[model samples]
Target chain A: MDDLHSPDPTEQSWGSLLRTNREEVLEKWTQTAAANLGGRMTPAEMGRDVDEIYSALVRADTGDQIDIRSAAYADLRSLLTELSRTRARQGFSPTETAVGVYALKDAVLEILEAHGDLPGYRAFARLSRIVDDLGMFMLETYATTREAVIAEQAEALLELSTPVVKLWDGIVALPLVGTLDSARTQVVMEALLQTLVDTGSEHAIIDITGVPAVDTQVAQHLLKTVQAARLLGAECIISGIRPQIAQTVVALGIEFGDIHTKASLADAILLAMRRSGLDVVKSR
Target chain B: MDRIPILRIGDVLLVSIQIDLQDQTALALQDDLSSKIVETGAKGVLIDISALEIVDSFIGRMISTTAAVSRVLDAETVVVGMQPAVAITLVELGLTLDGVRTALDVDRGLALLSSALGKAGSDVEVDDLAHE
Candidate 1:
């Protein structure tokens, strides 16, 4: 009974069985995934992703063992990873991205059910195992892709937050607006110091009004920044010290050591101007 | 055995250290600077370290000591043009060089020195008036 159309299920590998029904399986898989995604992706894009994965799966010679991590499935695994990365970048949920691979199981099962025999049922089970491994792989890829996206955004946020603004001639100001961790403080310190040299500004104001809390560690960071600026021969004035922050600084026994602290940015600018020998007088 | 040259501009003694200072060289420079400050009767001392890229803790201490010696001689000391990396390294080493003033460059250093001299002159005048 070695017929091309009706080969014995036990004698045929799942790869060959899959190849024989590739068109039907791909169409069914794409349709199910499209419904699951609520049509967020166009049909052409969905079809292309499904087509790539199906071709790679049919080419993989799983034989008896169904390890997706095996060398036999390397091509298939990479194809699935690529699909998941695209889905993740498009903002698809984990379940939605993984379901694209899982849908192949139902499509294969439908084809096996049409045969209606015990051997056909056994073949479906083996294929089902391979599909399960692939779905998990897709899920793992999705997680890593999302994590990469988050890390890139966090770095961008750090850059956007710390801006060394030139307030006036011989005066620059850094408006701090977040938690002062060691990493952020290091970035802030370097940027301020570089600006001090580039602009030849003798006075700098660090406005901490947006800083929500002041622990000993944060106070230490501020002191380090001011000291670094002083090394460049630029004086730094810490401004926007709300009453609460002042109390916290005193309570924590953090000695700013003669570094000027002002109540507001405006006051800090006024002091910086006075030190630079400039006075603002209103003209009538 | 090379000695760092000490240049005098107006009332400011300019010590531009261009070489990586050895311990003996630093000691010799310190001696020469102090004697020159006395001989010239300079009002301010400007140390341009922009050419120096590397400094150990010994050199850091030498700078502070030089400033102290200048201060005792009735001259203000200003360290100018310290590189950012050098500044960070010094801070990390915990050498803050307390009591030594800093400027961005020799131009700024001269300005700082003159302004300081101006203030000191006015303070002397006030003291004279108080004595009267």
Candidate 2:
């Protein structure tokens, strides 16, 4: 009979098991850790921490418990917070911090899973805050980026001498100042259209006098605006066609025959008055 | 993919089109928008396409159709934020938009509509004068 005290090579200590079967132990630990951290960490943080913990668990051996109770986890939390603040101060994109938070959460979860115990609720709470902060940071950064892009794009497209102003009669004048490209054309179209509806104006003067030139594309867009105005029974009078623009129009051989174009903004206002047949001229 | 949010400012309903207005989404949006316009009894509908990068033929047709339908419902339709490239592309593609009001933005579109409505009211006086 074998001696009762005989040691079996297969029944090794935790440390030896980790060393000899690192891959298998790590895999098992990762799954356990993720499960343990489930609902305790944000998705992003969990993802990050999972990788870290997996590495830590692979290094752990028999007689070694996954010690998330140590000050290391708290230090990690503080480090992440500092990193977030530092990144914010540096104006580095929040995405970077979000990525870091996710990694930390993942590592914590993995450690817990390998140990088959849960982190303290306080630790979980800290993780949650990190995730939330990162989410907000990312969202705000995205919104700012989006607004900046929109403003830049709109400025480029609209090319108006006066982008914004208020009128006493509530009739705002948006004098387009440069070439109308497809993107900017859309911005102008939308701005004018929305202005009409919002202000309930009887007339809108799109003075293109400052526009360098006109092509068939520009002409068509102008026509579309006119047609759109008529749909709402609103009249959009195109004004400010510099000689160069007129020459370009004629050169392109595009017909403004069906559309209304005025040599000047004054002409456009007069045309609008005539079209509306409003005799606003006061009698002395 | 689901319900599109339509914002109402005064008598005008501002519908911001951020997602791709294509196929089922277009049809769904049209149906939903038409019903909302009728229900809200809005005077005008402004389609804000500042977020859209592309406007296909189907979408263009839908816009025109929506405007026409809105008119029948006594609500005017205005399309705003049509990028110049989109305008050029649409024209080159031979897509015709009839009965759809357009402006540079929502504010201008509202002003134009108000002025047009005001003119319509005054036109009644003109008609009365002509009859006299």
Candidate 3:
């Protein structure tokens, strides 16, 4: 491409020009992005996202070091990280987020033409390499940050799902609502035990009214939790066993083996209270 | 030489593990504790592991074995003062130590022992008679 276009002074000339002409670059870049990748977003929002990346690119290029791992690129990485996080939360598709960087190619090309000092295809090629790298960077950042976001949300959901609410003095209720997985089972057992230790509770009612089904695997997970609780000196009452679940347990011949079973959360609560030596009396 | 000392406080046997139990020490402790249970005829056994910062499958098995042996001797075993981390590790290691009773501290463990033995004094005979 160098043979196709005229030569510029240096290899990094385009990068330097992009730095000096950031306003022009950003302005053109916004137009290109808003027109192509805006989807339901306003140009102002497009401008807000493009500006951070535009300035980052300028800083990265204008610095003495312009490599991917350079300290100069730190702001650029963080800007990409911020942009990726927001894009993910906004539910923008991955292509849309990457397009926010990719679409700048045409704008920069036009900017090069308007300046009449357009770097030769060689310089433009180098510039394209950097821009393409930045575009890919956005996608990679989006994927990584999205994974972290998912992990954090999973942890939050785990904590939320296994709430150990103290029903009475020396009685705790763990109302489980969702499909039980091994990861979630660990969280449930830990939270239940910690709560038991904290409250000195003697009984834990594991109410599974919100659980949709109970298979052999779910049964095993439940038993492991019950066994762990028993080891800690707290008896677990498996409650909310719907008629269908009861039939399934019989069909499977899975023995709960002396662990108390109840038909409803109410029954479990009553039993927990009674066993803990508390009487539920009506107040005047 | 590395036997875990078994102290008899009244009719209960208290074994506090103050050091990390090597494989040999754990085995020796298991042997010594079981014999002491039979020799002293203690109605309760309290194994306090508060000072132990770590427990592997071997250590866990030793505890389970000691509890089982104590059972044959007709004494209730209560493991007490397990640090929160140790408890979590034990669970994660898949060592529930099912036959063993657990308590938050030694005092609570002792109280549990008395009540358990009190139950054993009456209910255990019924279990024996039922078996017979």
Candidate 4:
């Protein structure tokens, strides 16, 4: 423990040591990082990213205590954040992105081995801690960026899933695929209602053929949507309820009330057309 | 209290609510509507609430009561021009307004009212013939 706090005779700091051997450390760091990244980035691009990070790190060293959360390391942390965010968006794994920072430890270790001095070993210990901190920081930023990407994809999927197709002059059909959650139901309701007002359609058909199952909550959402459409003076017909779903609905004792339901989308569309005062006859 | 105007369009009474209705104003409108229906002997009532952005339970109850009062006076009530947001709000608030009929807009409301009254007129005629 006493050896841990032993003062350097020459009073050398990691920052100055890094500066003296900056060219060697940076080249080795970039090379190791490039190899770790599996040639995903060009040599010039990787060199530029590492050069920016190296400059910020050199400036970030205030004293022996390298607290990454300090004001001095703020710039370095921001640079890491930007680098990790881009890597995350580029479909790089968390370990892969973080390994890029950890590569610096190996680069510094090689330099420390060449020096083979007692104070150089102590400085390397502190340097390795800072590298570990930066690696963890990159991991956190990567996680958050991946989370943001996932959230954006979910919103886009919600938009793409609910489409209100115009079946006839005064009829619209909403073909719902996948499971029905409250958030999805709200989107479907708003879109269907807006379309109704836009087209002035008197009849709407909600087809759930792509929907896998129907539970009590799903049934409740359907009822609310139908009631909302009815309040807008548009009749709603629920279609594409499979035989299994029908059994599940009845077994659960969920009352659909007066909302018209059909077995298939075609049947629902036919009902909507007939209600809109149109009849389809086979052409002889 | 501000009174909601009741316009006579042939046999259907059109009440276009263009203001944010307070409780007292809603009550006054209900009173005025009932009196107008009786005076004109209208066969149907169309309430256009498109301009109303905010509708609380008080206004919702007033609309239902107005429909009930119109029904008692031998007139069908068709509420029209309810905005999508307002309709969603009403449903979320559990005010389905089951007994009252609804239409997309004033024109559709008029058509629905006319057709409904036409059916009622023919049924009354059949009853008169039976009585004879």
- Maximum-TM-score candidate: 4
In model 3, residue pairs whose N, Cα or C atoms come closer than 3 Å (at least 3 residues apart or on different chains), thus clashing, are none
* TM-score, prediction 3: 0.74
- Best model per lDDT: 4
lDDT tens per residue, model 4, A22-52: 9999999999989988889887888998899
Q: Which is the leading candidate under DockQ?
A: 1
Interface RMSD of each: 7.0, 7.9, 7.4, 8.2
Write model 3 residue lDDT over A21-88, tens digit each, in one string.
Answer: 67877888888888876457889989998887777776676433436667778888888878888888
TM-score of each: 0.82, 0.37, 0.74, 0.87
Q: How do the residues B15-53 of candidate 3 rate in per-residue lDDT, one tens digit apiece?
A: 999998889999888888878877888888999887887
Q: Give the local distance difference test score of model 2.
A: 0.58
Mark the regions of model 1 whose C-alpha exceeds 4 Å error after superposition: A1-11, A20-24, A42-48, A62-75, A109-129, A278-284, B20-24, B35-43, B72-74, B118-132
DockQ of model 1 vs. true complex? 0.40
lDDT of each: 0.84, 0.58, 0.77, 0.85
Whose TM-score is higher: candidate 2's or candidate 3's?
A: 3
- Evaluated on CA atoms against the true complex, candidate 4 attains a DockQ of 0.39
TM-score of chain A of each: 0.83, 0.42, 0.75, 0.86
Docking class of 1: acceptable
Model 3's CAPRI class is: acceptable
Residue A246 accuracy (lDDT) in model 3: 93
Mark the regions of model 2 whose C-alpha exceeds 4 Å error after superposition: A1-258, A261-284, B114-119, B122-132
When sorted by DockQ, best at the front, the candidate numbers are 1, 4, 3, 2
Ranking by TM-score: 4, 1, 3, 2
